[model samples]
Target: MLNFGNMHNSVWIGVDIGTTGVRAIAYQKNGVNLCDSNEFYPLETPYPDWAEQNPEIIYKATEKVIRDTANTLIYKGIPVSGIAISTVMHSFAPANEKRELLSNMITWADSRSVEIVNELKKDIKLTRNFYEKTCCPVHACYPFLKILWLKKTFPDVFSKMKYIYSLKDYVFEKLTNKWVIDKSSASASGLYNAHKMDWDEDILSFADIRKEQLPPVVSTTYSQKLTPDAAQRLNLPKGLPVVIGATDGVLVNVGIGAVKPGQLSATIGTSGAIRMLTKNPKVDKKNRTWCYNLTDDMWVAGGAINNGGIIMRWMRDKICHYNSRRLDDIDIDPYDLMTLKASKIPAGAEGLLLLPFFTGERAPYWNSELRGMFFGLSLNHSRSHMIRAAMEGICFSLNCVLTALKDFGKIEDIRVSGSFTKSTLWLQIISDIFGENITLPQNSEGAAFGAAVLGFIASGEMNSISDTANLIQSKKIYYPQKENFLTYKELFDIYNNLYQKLQPEFTRITTYQNQMYK
Candidate 1:
């Protein structure tokens, strides 16, 4: 039994629609967390290289979490000020005129459109032009290629869809009966022009879709009142203001208090990204990074890796199955056990190397045909060694993004968050690999806390988004070690060289697999 009378003056809620689940978090004005609740849904993979989820299932989970969190706060006599949302980017579903989903939402991890992206890449000039306009390369994970794939493969569904809405947009319509998409999510679709802050006509024409088929793009801070039905479902007041927040990547930067130039944020969750705030859109000459709009004056410039902590999850469930299950039965966290085992291994994992790309990869490579591999395995290598290599591989992959971001501006220290922070060993590995200090926030709520901050700003409880730094306190810091950095530098060189050497083989294998399956 907690005391509700001792709570702060006001509280705001942040609803995060993530890849694995939906979380509704309540935070006080000063950044103290009052309560949080989460509801998880499942990812559907009917075929290899395909990832999707039913929108209605996700909405139901969202409703449950929101209602649970709201009821918890209300029970404590806390008055909800406002609510904001943070959602995964690059997910969209076809919908009818009634805003009902025509198909499952295609997630960012889906690689079914790899063939479409390869075809688009055949025209180098056109690919470069689109990349310049949208700041997203020809990749299977992006909605631009997904749209092309859908139109080509499912003509009937394409013809019937009245609108294409991202997961956030679909949920927003359910809550408010209004079709709208934030510029941050829109910009990530590879169909929106960051410079013009509108749908790119050329890209839309290429995808064989019209502007009218997409939801209207709105600002990040755009707000609307919840519908009476939605309000009742969540047991909240009718007409409660809901702010349309930015995508998870941008909000992660905000939640970690990386709002200014020279500040970078590295978030390793189910997926991972390394992002930095910039005043203007920073486009890489090599087109290896993304520059998504965060606000009218701010842009997020960085790269994302499709594999992060997910690779560890894969190892725990598949390779270390017996140990994981045993640990679970004993009421111990399997990841903690794995990390403890990994810490006993040498810095280089005894010459073992893992690619960490179970679902292809993003950022820097943007190659969906690439697959995971474990190189330099020997008889002496144990499961613990493999775990260390996997963790190191994840760090090296994110370091690729950090190196790319350095081309745009200076990054002295990285503000870190997400599931990766739970492991001190992983944090030290990240610090050594990046050769910089890793700063952790007091509350590692990631995107949800950022969404709450946005809600506070929208409701006039906070002055500006820049106040995020003042609101968060530094919890811990991990500094790079000299010897560890040197060893990682050598290993990273091998990791980089191995990827280039394996590119042709990756393509060949993908082609053979697709042909065999067909």
Candidate 2:
């Protein structure tokens, strides 16, 4: 129970429906964090490359956090002005006319529709047409392809589905009994026309669905009141205005105050993305990046990598099992210990290179068949060398996205957020690899803070979104080291060449694995 009694008279609550958990943060108008609460939910992978979650569990988790945070604030007599929501993008769940979920929510990481994506890629005309309209490429992660996958494999469920909704839309329906989605979430679906701000009839026809099956698109700052039942269950005041925030990825830009033209924001959480704000939709000629709306006039153009801090979790569980488990006894956090061990190794990991595609990949190369590989292992290498290489590999993957982002706008500096900022070593690694200065904001709550900013704007506390950059403060700045940048520049070439050289093998391996399963 945190006290907010002496804090600023005005406070706003922001709820983030993240991939790993649900978090609610209470923030003052000046961007100070009053209190926060979080609850984790299980992510199920019943088969390989298939990620799913129960909508009911997610809704319950959302309810618990909101209740916990709101009650704490109210107990302290802090008047909460409004509530806002931010959620993960590209999540799909089918529901009946009554709004009853007909299937588990399919997340962005799920690759069950990979084959359909590949098939669409073979038809350049169709793929390019959709990409030109939606600003999202033909990928298994997009709901457009996912709908085709459902119709082909689960026709019974597909036929029964009266509407398709993203995770945020489903949660909104649970809270307000409304079927409206924000423009940012709709833009990521590969079904919405960015220019028109509506569902694309052509794409819908390709997926064998109609426009009526999707929620109506609304602005990111759209607001609705919480229903009476929802208000009572969450211990909130009836008719509390709920501001509809944008997708977490887009809102992260707002949260970090990266609304300027040349400033890029990178978030390295379970997955990672590098985005820049633009006045107009910026579509890549090569169709490698996604352009999603933050508002009617503003769009976030960037690429996302499916693997980020998740690879570190894998190393802890499988490779450093003993060391990680014993960290508690040594009074050291496991990740800190891991970083400490890796620091002993020299830069470039002493000639070892790791391509971290453990969970396939995204951005630059949307190849789901690509697997993780350590390309330059030697007999002299130790576990520490592998750990250092893993860290470098993750940065290298993000650098690839940064390279693609240059086509849209010039990146002057990077404002970074996410759990990875906990490690100074990781921060320096990203700085050196990108050859740019990295700034960490004082309020590193990311999307949750962005949602609060939206609430402030909606409640007339803040003048505009750009005004938040002046309100938020920066904590630290990490500059790139010239020597390390040179080393990474050389290694990055090998990193790119390794992927190209291994592309054929990746496809062959996928073929063999499929035959074996058959």
Candidate 3:
């Protein structure tokens, strides 16, 4: 129902194929989003520390969203000019040469490849070689090790695999018959070299994967005409350009105008990420932080914690059970109420700390066995305090990532975008935690907008990606309160100390959980 203008004025579609859902949005020439439709699909967790989703499910969602959006556009008498897609990184679905799914896509959070990661560490030269080549550590959170796991454990699937593609690459190929990937997505996969901007043969050797198995590395603006079959499925004109977009995390930085060297973006979506752009590749000595190329010359350096907004949802469903109270009121979401209650509590949640590891920990702590904990809970603490603690805890975790990036380079400011940024209080709290100003985008067009910019550039409608900053603008800025900053600073120290104290306990918990589940 939201219409910016007619297709004659400006028309393009941006599709975001996320872990849980697929969304397609129509946009005007000036970057104003017209309308969007999304289709949801649940992710599967067959075992502890394992996460995955059927590629067919995602593909179906993609088809549904694009078709519905195109139908809506038809209703408005405007044919979409082109389509662009952005997706999460570190997820791969192997396929035969014809591009049929060989198995379910291995997600970034799947730690089933832990054995491979550990084995990779044993060879210091191999570890150093991969880091030097790909600029990504040998972590379980990548397709390289995931492929290795499949090849060793599930040889049938591995042998059947003729082509390897990330979720986005598969979708793009389905639409255009082109096997391609953007630099941003490729660099994060532990298969491509971040500095050299190509697949690292040495690292490929480590994984025992060949160049023939991977998708052709392409720029974000790399485009092709949509196939007739896809055009019929989506009800769009054939030959419309389909731009290759990077991962949603890097596109988020572009969407929020956080492309500057010192400015970064910290997003809290289904998962959380703290990202800053670097002209040169920056690697952490401990291999904790990941360095990914954003463009040929620019790179994104950051860390990811799989538990971000998921923690808030968990607290709402399992802890608060607010939905049970207001089952009839479908209009009001429980998470909004939780956020409202959280805003009432003062900074630091009165000494309550939530370890937000309901799905294990990433970044500084790569432990898959780390369990979520509410340290320092008391009778005096209410549900509101618990909710506040959860929110603050996620921000505090992001602060840890920021601290690591700071060790690598300078961070003068941060731009935050995501569903969580809608809460002004949460933005203020994050600013307080970071001890700096955090700006929110006026309109969160999601990765689609940035991808559209890429599409426009590819189509010769725009000059460059840097010109996108002029189109996107910030709405409000949250400056740190000195008192709240001091409060969070002291509490963050406690947060660090708690991790140190709970390390052994977490390991024990993981060991027991692993035994029980496995």
Candidate 4:
């Protein structure tokens, strides 16, 4: 093993295996990010609404990031002490006895099993009992429904499976030669009991899966040394301690140091999330807000919206004409310039409100057939006006979720993070719509940073998880303007009514589409 004494100071690493790529980042104990590396991998969509990643390709890319990072550290004469892994949640795949992936990793974005989700939701005995135990709703994102789809459709693959693992567990197994998962991730799987910290036998029986098919669940601080093979591949010392990490979403909240109660977190990346931590496990009776464990005693209550930045990308490619006029070498990304142009327009976008259900609604409405619309538009509306309205509509969609937390569960103030916070205009919109001040953390490295902090705590360098939160400093805060609060309240009410009014029409369109596919 490389001697740790030669290092300048304690160096920790965090590996975030995301939907698009793998990122390996190194940080110091004081929350300063030193260096980072990233590698992209393609996502496969064999059929409509089916998103899968070749687990082997993802693993190889992850190996490359670590190896390249280690090489960079060696060039700089920096020694690595530890590493941890965090990933997107609820996706699962089958693995053989040798820890090789036997099937494509089913990502959370996949909707191939929507039919199964609909059927399960109709089963009160199954849905009620499962939610009571697991604290998760029966949705297409849940592994239990995915397993059902696999068994009913691909019986041969299901019968030959030795074990089923979430993407998080698969990565951990690759590093440590051990198959185990932490509570934060397990709770999101729909097969785990968030309150009890164990797999729900009732849900497992419903899925017809056994304990042996899943990894053992452990605390977030559980530590294991890396195996010789993994060490060689990553160019790190063998037997280096690696800490079990939480889900990227949970850790993103932590990374921004938003651990205090009522400090809500909103992240907009591949998708959007609005979450906050609470002491007790509380689920929204209507199942609008999802409740999952973040720690042994802490629970996260929030909602995930299916449409986020992806909508902006769609507008950029399929709708925006201004971006087409620019030359290739202008050094301008259409996305940033579009946001800049949208910022110039006034609030409310001149009575225009966009329903950002381009990909269908996930939370609050839960309507799969909902279509996007531009409401209250006039002939005077410009592309900038439409773009600004779309951004506002996205914020309003998030506000719909935040309002639910306040009205349903009585959650208070929220802290915001992710790349979207950099936009002063967007943050102000969020603040005004929610009618609460939004705090932006000084360190927005997010999930990767949170994983490194967990490693630091596991190594006995930090006394408590809160230590990371304390180190965070706020760079800016967005407080709502009282004058516009009433306008937003009226617009939000209209926003809620739009879904109810359009549900029947949406159902008809979806029925036609399904018939066509059939």
My TM-score estimates for the predictions, one after another, are 0.96, 0.95, 0.93, 0.92
Best by TM-score: 1
lDDT of 1: 0.87
Off by over 4 Å in 4: 1-8, 96-102, 321-328, 407-413
For candidate 1, write residues 1-518 as lDDT tens digits. 11122223667789889998889999887878889998888878666688999888999999998899999998998878777899999997887777677888999999989988888889999988888888888899899888888888998988888889898888888898888999999999999998888998887887788999998999888888888999999998888888889999989888878887688999999889999988877788887999898777788899999998778878888988857556778989989889999999989898999988878999999999998899999999999999999999999999998888888877766899888899999999999999999998887877998888877777666776788877778899999999999999999999999999999999898788767667
Which has the better TM-score: candidate 2, or candidate 4?
A: 2
- Per-residue lDDT of model 4, residues 1-518, tens digit only: 32333234878888887777788888888888778899988767655456788888888998898888888888898888888778888788976666566789898777667777777778777687677778777777778778888988888888877899888777788788878999988888889987678998877887888988899999887778889999988899998888888888888777888777667788876668888777887777777777887667677778887777777777887778646557346977787788888888877888889999766666766555666889998998988898888888888888777767875445555677766776788788888888888888887668888888788777777766677768888888888998667778888889878877888887676567656756
For model 2, name the residue pairs that clash: none
**Candidate 3 runs further than 4 Å off:** 1-8, 96-98, 122-125, 324-330
Tell how far residue 289 is off in model 4, in angstroms.
1.4
**Clashing residue pairs in candidate 4 (N, C-alpha, C atoms within 3 angstroms):** 264-414, 264-415
Quote the positional error of residue 162 for candidate 1 in Å: 1.8
Candidates 1 and 2 compared by TM-score, better number: 1
lDDT of each: 0.87, 0.86, 0.80, 0.79
By summed lDDT, the worst window of 10 consecutive residues in model 4 runs over 1-10
In angstroms, the error of model 4 at 146 is 1.0
The lowest-lDDT stretch of 10 consecutive residues in candidate 3 is 1-10
Q: Report residue 427 deviation for candidate 1 (angstroms).
A: 0.5
Clash totals for all models, in order?
Answer: 0, 0, 0, 2
TM-score of 1: 0.96
